[model samples]
Target: MGNLKSVALLLLFTFFVLHLPFVESDWFINYHIHVTNDLPLLNSPPNQPNLFLHCKSKKKDLGERPMVKGQDYTWDTKVNFWRTTLFFCRASWVGRKTIRFDAFVADRDEMTCRHYHNSCMWSVREKGIYFSKNNATWGNMYPW
Candidate 1:
C-alpha cells in the first residue's frame, strides 16, 4: 500500500510539472502586436506612397502588406515553450530606404507585454518607429 501511494503521488507531481507552462493563466501570456502607419501625408505633393511591410517569425510569415497613412496591421502570437520565439519585420516606401527590425522577441518583450495586458503597439512615422505599452503614450524605439 505504501509503495502504491508513493507511486501515485510521484505521477501526480510529474503531471503538474509537465502541464504547468500550458495552463491558461497569467503565466502563459498571449501577445498581440499592432503595427500602424502614422506617417503624415505630404501637403505639397497630393500623392503619398503606401508603406510596405513584411513581417515573419521562424515558424510563420505574415507576408507583404501595404498600409496607407493612419492604417494599422495587427497579429497575435504566444511565446513558445523554449521562449525562443522571435518575429522580425521590414518596412519600406517608394523613395526611402528599407528599415528592418525585430517586431517581437520573446525574452525582450515578455515582461513589457505581460505588464501592459499582453499588447505591443508600434507606430511607423516619417522619422522612425515608436513603441507603446499603452495606446495612449508612445516612445521612439527605432529610427529610419
Candidate 2:
C-alpha cells in the first residue's frame, strides 16, 4: 500500500510539471492610442480640424498587467500627442480573440463606444490605428 501511494504521488508531480508550460502558454499583447485633444482648436475651422493625434498606434511593455492611465505611463510613440497611448492584452470574444486596448482611455466616447470605438483609437502594442467609421480608411503608419 505504501509503495502504491508513493507511485501515485510521483505520477501527480510529474503530470503537473509537464503541463506547467502549456497552462501558461497564453502570451499577452498590449495596444495604445495617442490622441491630441486639440481642445484649443475645437473652435477652429472644419477643414483644419484641431483634433489630431501623433500617429496611430503606440505600443509599450507593462509586464502582464492590464493597461491603465496612471499606473502604466511608459509610452512608446515616435510622435508626441496630448494623451499618451496605453493598453494591455486580455482574453476576449468568449476566448476567441485576444483583445488589447488602453486600460483607462477607450477608442471613442461612451456614446460611440459599442459600434465604432476601437477604430477611433490606435493600438500601441498592436502598432495599428483603429477607426469605427471604416476600418480600411486608416493610413499605414508605425505606432508612435
Candidate 3:
C-alpha cells in the first residue's frame, strides 16, 4: 500500500511539472496611438468626432475617449485566445460620415526567450495610419 501511494504522488508531480509550458497566460499589453497633424483623416466637415479605439479583446466597449492632434492615447487590453487580439479606431465626430481604420496591434509570434517590449506603437502618417509591428510599408493594412 505504501509503495502504491508513493508512485501515485510521483506521477502527479511529474505531470504538473511537464505541462507548465502549455498553460495559457493572462499577459496584457499597452497599445499607444499617436495622431499626427501631417496626416489628415478627417473630411471637409472636420467634425472632430470623439476618437476612440475599439478592440475585439476579452472585453469590448472599453470606453470611448476623444483624441487630440499630436497626442497619444494609451489603451490597456488583454491578450485573447491564441495570444492574438484585433484593434481598430473609429471616428464619427458628427454628421453622417463614420470611419473605421485598422490600428493593427497584435503579437502572433510564438513565445521567445528574448525580451519583448510587450507594447505596440502606431502613428498617424501623411498617407494612412501605419501599424507598429508591421513594417511602415504602404498598403500593409492588417486583416479586418
Candidate 4:
C-alpha cells in the first residue's frame, strides 16, 4: 500500500509539471493592439491636422504620440492575472474636441482578440473611432 501511494503521488507530480507550460501559455497570452490615423489628409502645410494619442492602463502609461494621416501605432501587452486588465486612450486633433475611449477591456476584448489571433485594431476617423478584429470589417465604437 505504501509503495502504491508513493507511485501515485509521483505520477501526479509529473503530470502537473508536464502540463504547467500549457496552462501558463493559455493564461499569459500577449495581445497586440494597433491604432491608426485614418483621417483625411489636410492640405495645410504648417497646420496639418495631426492626431495625438495617449494610451494607458492602470500599470502602464504610453506617452502621447503624434500621428499624421495613414500613420499607425502599435503595442503588445499581457492581460493581468485577475482578468481585469483595461487600457484606454485619449485622442485629440487640431480642431476637434479631445475624446477618450477604452481601447482594451479584458472582459470585452478577450474573446474577440482570441478569435483574431490576439490582435485588436483601431482606426481614428473624422466621424468616430472604429474597431476591428481582422481589419477587414470595422464597427463604429465611439463618435467624435
Candidate 5:
C-alpha cells in the first residue's frame, strides 16, 4: 500500500511539472498595424477620391485591422490611404491631425497591453510621413 501511494504521488508530480511548460508557453510577442489620415475631397478626376494600398507585413504577428479605436475621431480629409508604418497607440500626441491610436494586445497572463505607441505609418503614397499636414482635427472619419 505504501509503495502504491508513492507511485501515485510521483505520477501526479510529473504531470504537474509537464503542465507548467504549456502554461508558460503563453509568453509570446506580437505586433499590430493601424493608419489614419484625411485628405480634402478635391472636385476633379476622382469624384469620390478614396485611397487604397497593397500592404504586406514583415512580421507574421502584425496584421491589419480597420480602426482599433472608433469612438473619438472624425475624418477631416475626404480621400486618404494608410498602411502600417509601425505599431501605434492612442497615447502620444504627434500633432494636431495625428493622435495616438491604442492597440489592445494580450500577454502570457492575458493581461491587456494597450496603447503601444506611434509605430505605424501611412503607405508610401498616403504620405503619412511628412508629419506636417498632421494638424487637422479629428472629424467623423476614423479608420476608413
Candidate 6:
C-alpha cells in the first residue's frame, strides 16, 4: 500500500509537469487608445479631413477608430498574451499639418496593462502631435 501511494504521487507530479506548457495563464492584457482631434476644422476631404487610429498584430488589423474635429475617440483592443502589437494612432488626412502617433506595445505588465483607462493618448494640441500615458501629462511626439 505504501509503494502504491508513492507511485501515484510520483505519477501525478509528472503529469502536471508535462502539461505545464499546455496550461494557459489568465494574464489579461489590453491597450486603450485615447484619440482626440482638437482642431477647429478638418481640411477638405481628399486633402486630409480626419485622423485615423488603427492597431494590428502580425499585420492583421485588430481594430480602428476615426477622430473627428472637436471631439474625443477612445478605442480598446486586446493583445495576444505577450505578443507585440503595432499601434498606428495617427494618419494623414489632408497635408503635413496633420499630427500622428505610431506606438508599439511589448510583453510587459507596465506596457500591456489589461485594465486601464486611457493607457495611451494620441492627440493634436497647438498644431502638434502629442502622446501620453495619461491625459493630464503630455509628451511631444511629432510636429504638425
lDDT value, residue 29 of candidate 2:
17
Question: Stretches of candidate 3 above 4 Å error?
Answer: 1-58, 80-84, 91-116, 134-144
| Global lDDT of model 1 | 0.81
Report the lDDT tens digits of candidate 3 across residue range 33-103: 33322235456334453344443333465455655445465555554545566566664333333456644
- Going through the candidates in order, what is the number of backbone clashes in each? 0, 11, 1, 0, 19, 3
By lDDT rank, best first, the candidates go 4, 1, 6, 3, 2, 5
Residues 1-144 of candidate 5: C-alpha lDDT, one tens digit per residue: 999999999998997687654344322323223343234323323333233222232333333222321212221111111222222333221122333332322221122211233122232112232221123322232232
* TM-score, predicted candidate 2 vs. hidden true structure: 0.19
Return the candidate ranking by TM-score, descending.
4, 1, 6, 3, 5, 2
Which runs of model 2 end up more than 4 angstroms from their true locations?
Answer: 1-26, 40-144
Q: Which candidate is the best by lDDT?
A: 4
Please give the CA lDDT of all the candidate structures: 0.81, 0.34, 0.46, 0.84, 0.30, 0.56
Q: Tens digit of lDDT per residue, candidate 4, span 1-144?
A: 999999999998997797775456646789999999887766534445478999999889998998878778898887775679899999996566689999999878977987788999999988889999988999999998
* 1 versus 5: better lDDT goes to: 1
lDDT of 2 by residue, 5-87 (tens): 99999998997687654334311112232322212222344444222122223454434323221122223322123334334
Count of backbone collisions in candidate 4: 0
Model 1, runs deviating above 4 Å: 1-27, 43-49
lDDT of 1 by residue, 1-144 (tens): 999999999998997788775555434677999999877666423245468889999889999987778778899888886778899999885466579988899878877876677998899888888888878788888888
Worst 10 residues of 2 by lDDT: 26-35
